[model samples]
Structures are given as C-alpha cells and as structure tokens.
Target: MISGSIVALVTPMNADGGVDWAALERLLELHIEAGTGAIGAVGTTGESATLSVPEHCEVIKFCVDSVAGRIPIMAGTGANATREAIELTRAAADAGADCCLLVTPYYNRPTQRGLYAHFRAVADAVDVPQILYNVPGRTAVDMDNEVVAELATHRNIVGIKDATGDRERGRDLIARCGDEIAVYSGDDPTAMDLMLAGGKGNISVTANVAPRQMAQLCALATAGDREGASAINELLTPLNSALFLEANPIPVKWAMAQQGLIGEGIRLPLIVLDEQYHADVRAALEAAGV
Candidate 1:
C-alpha cells in the first residue's frame, strides 16, 4: 500500500497551455525531497479532463521515469468510457506506474450495477492494482459502500479513495472492507479524521503546495499520534480550505505559482484563480506557514 501524503500532482503548463516538462521535474523533486509517500500523476488536480490521451500517457510515463522507483506512482487512468479507462490503465502499467486510480464515470450516471460492471471490467482487463475513486461531488454518481465491498473482493482492486467526507460512512466502509482493501481519504479537510478512523492515507490536493507539512501530518495521523497530527492539521486547515476556493487546481495552481513553483498556465473552461480570493488564499498559505 502506498501510504502517507500522495500528492494529486498538477501538470505544470506553459503560458500557452503546453506541459512544462522542466517545471514538472522541479515539482517532482519538491515532493521527493519532502518525503511524500507517492504521487498521483495526471489525476484530477492534473486536469485529466483536459489532457489529450497521448498527453496523459506521456505525463504518466514522465512521472514514472523521473521518480525512478523512488516511490510509488498512482496514475490517473479513469474515464467516462470504459474502454478508454482500460487503455489508460494499460498505458500506466506499461509506463511502470505502481498502481492506477480510477474515478467513477462522471456525467453519465451509472446505476449501482452499472458502476460495478464498469469498474469490474477495467479491473479484469488490467492486471495492475487499481484504486477506486468515489467523489460524488464531481462524478454525480454515488457508489454505495455495498458496491465498494463487492468491488474490494477482486484481487486487483486493492483500495478505494473515499472523498465523501462523511465520517460515519467512511467508518462504516472501513469496518466493512478495511481488511480487504485500503481506504484512502480524498477530502483534505476531513482527511485526518478519516486516517485516525483507519484510513490508509490521503490522496491530497494540499500536498501540491505544502508537501512536507502534509507528509508530516499523514505520518503522525497514521502512526496514531492524534496530538502531533492535529497540530500539523491545524496549521494546514486554512490551506486545505483555501485550495478549494474555486474548483481544484485553480486555487492550488495559483498558490504554487505564487511560491514560484510553477508558471501561470491552465486549460480552457478552467481559468486562473480570481483576484477576489487571492487574499484569502494568500492568508491561508501564510497561516499554514507554507
């Protein structure tokens, strides 16, 4: 199980929207130096929706090559199309990703049965370990724990990133399938509580900016050090909230740019962070000591 703060890495881009390879190398070095447990390349925060298929594969391959087996790489291989997901998963595995993160099919609301079949098909088609991602807020399709439990039984279906933020539901899921599969927290604000409740780790957005701090928090929390973890979480609380001020990556990318980590570049339909929220995010970064 790839544990601790696994950054849902952003694909740094040039001002004209081209992938910035050099900047990406810098960011990878940032996480590696921070002792980040893993990297989620081309995931949501990486703007998976916007990247072309070839581009997506390229990014994953780049990450795998750059990391050089130093840490696990969970490539974002989910797609609304089952075939596409399978292809991406295959590509990630071929590229040497340690695992694949498959989000529930979005926009097309599949029934529980459909969801099961969709995920199962991918898992069956790909031999690599797969982690299910349930973010109803983004997918519009809520995967019930029962569905997750059923999926967990697959030897290749090794984990789930539960972003529901419902602690009770998370606890229930953990009780039902923690022994079968690892459950990771995708919601940053509630991540600590989930980890303390037995979540394996966090697939985090905040880590994009504060990798060292988030890594520390995850280590403390997973070690059952509530006080130590909470102290770090408290410092990061504002950053966790601020990053989502406008859809992900928008605020987070801006924060990283402000820190001179990446340039100001994002794809269409998703613009740069608004000026109104700049102060809020900045204050949050300062408060978090980022």
Candidate 2:
C-alpha cells in the first residue's frame, strides 16, 4: 500500500557533471526528515534517459543505502525493451529497493496486449513489488484502463502511478479495480481531486521542493479534509505550475538551487533553466513561502 506524497527525487549533480553522492545523501535525509511518504530515483525527474545503466544502478543503490529503512524507496527501472526492464528491476530488487516504478514503453508504442505482456513479464521475473507508470505524454504510449485492470491481477503488480489527469478515467479505474490496485496520482495539479475521488496518494514532482506542504495536502485529502487540502493546494498551485516552465527536472533543479538544495549543474541536452524563467519561478517560490 504505497501511498501519499511520494517524491520523484532529482539526482543532484556537481558543476563538473558528476553524480554528487554527498548531496544525494543530504537530499535523502531531508526527505525522510520532512515526512515524504516514499522516494523514487532515476524517474523522469532524475534524468533517467541520460544516465548510463551503471549510473542508474548506482543511484538506486545509493538511495537504498542512504535511506537505511527510514522510508520506502521506489526505484525507476522502466525501459522500452522488456528484457531491459526486467534486468533493471532485478538489479533494483538486488539493491534492496522496496519496489520499482515501471513506466510505459517509450517510442516503441507497444499494443495493449504488448503492454500486458511487458508488465506481466517484469512482475513474473522480479521478486519485488511493481507499480505501473502510465504517463503517455512522456512515453507516447498510453496504458489503457483495461490493460491496467488486466495487469492488476498479477500478484507483484501492486499499484499504478496515474499521471493521466483524467478524473473520469481515474474514477472508472477505481470503481472497476478498487479491490485489486492502489491508484496513485502522478500529476500534481489534480492530485487533491484524484484523492477526493478515491486515489490513495500522489507520486508528486512538487513534493521535491515542498515535501511538508505536499505531504500535508495528501494527508488532508486522504483524511477527507477537503477544506484544509484546498487551502494548502491554493498556496502550492503556482509552484506546481511553474516547475514545468521547462521539461520537468530542468525547472525543478532550478527551484532546488534557489533554495540552496543542490548546485545549478544539469546534464547535457538538458540545459539550466533559461534566465528568462527565473523571475517567474522565484515569484512562485516566494508565493509558496519556499
């Protein structure tokens, strides 16, 4: 039952473009202390595509070691190839991650049957909990509700990170698969609404910068505190929206640097936040009192 504000954590990097293990340790400690419900590494926010296989495994292992059972760590082990996904997932299980977040196959655009086979293969191969990630916007292959329902029957396929942001679809999935799957919102903007509609929690990008507030919001929404959640969400809405001024972690990394959480160095192909967007992000931070 992985639920609540599970942060898709950013991998900290130094000016020389190396994985800053010390900074990563500090970030892990900060999240655990701040009451983050779970931690996910090497997801979109962590720049998974750019990282080599060894770096990916190293990051997952580092997160598992750093957390030391303080919190659940869900490592991103998704790939376009089924064999690759299984390999990464097996490595994560070996690294002691509590679970793995498997995003839909990207670029390859596998069919619904292919999607089922893909997830089923990983669940069968790995001896760990698995959460399906259906963010078609990034993967370009939407995992339909029927496919998800089909996968829910697998023992190790425990849950899903639903970034679809479609309340009707989310509600329908909850209605049909309520007893089988735990549905988590992967989109920050509609997280409260999703929770109100019977979602367990959020796998939130916004939580990276505002863990306490995000956790509080999820708690309030899950506990039926709609008024309290709404008030807090109003305060956080700007930060949530601004964090996407560029593709994910670019702006998120920038937000972190503003708070002095990490250095400003982002990897190649994904440059630093453009100077033009600084004022907007800064204002959003101030508005949220970050």
Candidate 3:
C-alpha cells in the first residue's frame, strides 16, 4: 500500500485562471523533497470540479512525468457521469499514474446499488488500481459500509479514502473491509486517529502547505507511535481546522500563498480567502510552526 502523507495538491493558477505550469512543477518538487509518500493530483483540493477534461489529464501526466517514478501519483479521475469517470480513469492509467482516486458521483445521490455499479464499471473498464472516495458532505451520496465491503472484493479496487471524519464509523469500516482493501483517512483533523486505528495513510489537504510536518505525522501515526503522532497532530489540529474555515482550497490556497508557495489565484464560484479569517489562519499557521 502507498502509505504516509499523500498530498491532495492544488493546481496553481495564474491570476487569469490559467494553470501555472511553473508553479505546478515547483509544487511537485516541493512534495517530493518534503518526503510526501505520494501526490494526489487534481483531487478535490486540486479543484477537479473546475478543470477541463484535457487539463485534468494533462496535470496527471505532468505529475507522473515530473516525479519520474520517484513516488506514486494518485490521479483524481472521479466524475458524476459514469462514462466520464471511465474515460478519466483510462486517461490517468495511460498517463502512467500509479493509481486513481474516484469520488462518489456528486449531485446524483446514487443509491447503494447505483454506487456499487458506478465504481465497479470504472474499475472494470480501467486496469489501474482504484481508490474509492466517500465524502458525502460534498457529494451528497454516501457509500454504506456493506456496499463498500462488497466493492472491495474487486481486484483493482485497492483502497478507500474515508473522509467521513467519524472515528466510530471509520473503525467499523476498517473492521469490515480492512482485510480486503486498505483504508485511508481523507479527513485531516481526525486523520491521525484513523491512521492509529489501522488506516494505511492520509489523502490530505494540510500537506499542501505543511508537507514535511504532515508526512512526519502520518509516518508516526501509521507506525503505531501514539505519543509521537499525538504531539504533531495536536500542533496541526488548529491549522487543520483553519484550512476548512471556508471550504478546502480557499483557505489552503491562501495559506500556501502566504508562505509564497503559490500565487493568489482561485477559480470562479470560489474566491480568495476572506480578509476576516486571515489573522486566525495566520495564527494557526504560526502555531503549527508551518
């Protein structure tokens, strides 16, 4: 299993909303140098919803080529449409991505059977290893544990990024499907606890800003070192909460820009972080020593 902190990277953009290729390359190098286990290119944090199909595939290919097999690349290939999901997954595989993360169909609110069929169809169509993403708060469709366990039986379905943030439910999912597939925490604040409960790793947004620290925390937590992990998690908890202050990349992008990692560019429907939360976020970053 690909373990440790897998950064859900942000797609750096120019002020004109164009993908900043230079910044993207720098960010990739940043994660690799920081010892991030993998890079989740074009995932939610990467603004998968906004990128065009060609851009999405191009980003994945860019990451794969830039990394040069140094570490695994988990491409975000999920879509609300089954055909699009399959096409994206195929594109990622062709781009030589190590794996793909497919979020549940958003706005579709697929039933359990529909969810199973949707994921299965993609897994069957593409040969790449697939990781299921369950973030109902964003997608509005929840994949039940029983349904997830059923899908885990597929040879190509290697893992699930459970972003539910409910430790009890996460523990139950681990017990139910841990034997069949690796479980990864997609929720940052509760990530350490989930890892200590046998989660393989974390698909994290926090790593976008504090890659080195998040990587260290994941290593400690997954290795069963509660004290070491707790120390880091406690420090990161505030930043983790702060990042979600206005939904995902909004805050994380601002945080990254503050550190001079990227520019102040966010796509439409999602503007820059509010000035009101600036002090609080900056304080959190300072507290976490980012």
Pairs with steric clashes in candidate 3: none
lDDT of 2 by residue, 1-290 (tens): 77788999999999977898988999999988888999988999999998899999999999999899989999999999999999999999999999999999999999999999999999999989999999998989998999899899999988899999888888888887868988999999989998988899999899999999998999999888899999999999999999999999899999999899999878999999999999999999889878
Residue 269 shift from truth in candidate 3, angstroms: 1.0
Total backbone collisions, model 2: 0
Point out the worst 10-residue segment of candidate 3 by lDDT: 108-117
Give per-residue CA lDDT, model 1, range 1-290, as digits (tens): 88899999999999999999999999999899999999999989999999999999999999999999999999999999999999999999999999999999999999999999999999999999999999999989999999999999999999999999999999999999999999999999999999999999999999998999999999999999999999999999999999999998899999999999999999998999999999999999999987
Question: Which pairs in model 2 have colliding backbones?
Answer: none
Worst 10 residues of 2 by lDDT: 170-179
lDDT score, residue 141, model 1?
95
Per-residue lDDT for 156 in model 2?
96
- Using TM-score as the measure, name the better of candidate 2 and candidate 3: 3
Error of 1 at 37 (Å): 0.2
In candidate 3, how many Å is residue 259 off? 0.3
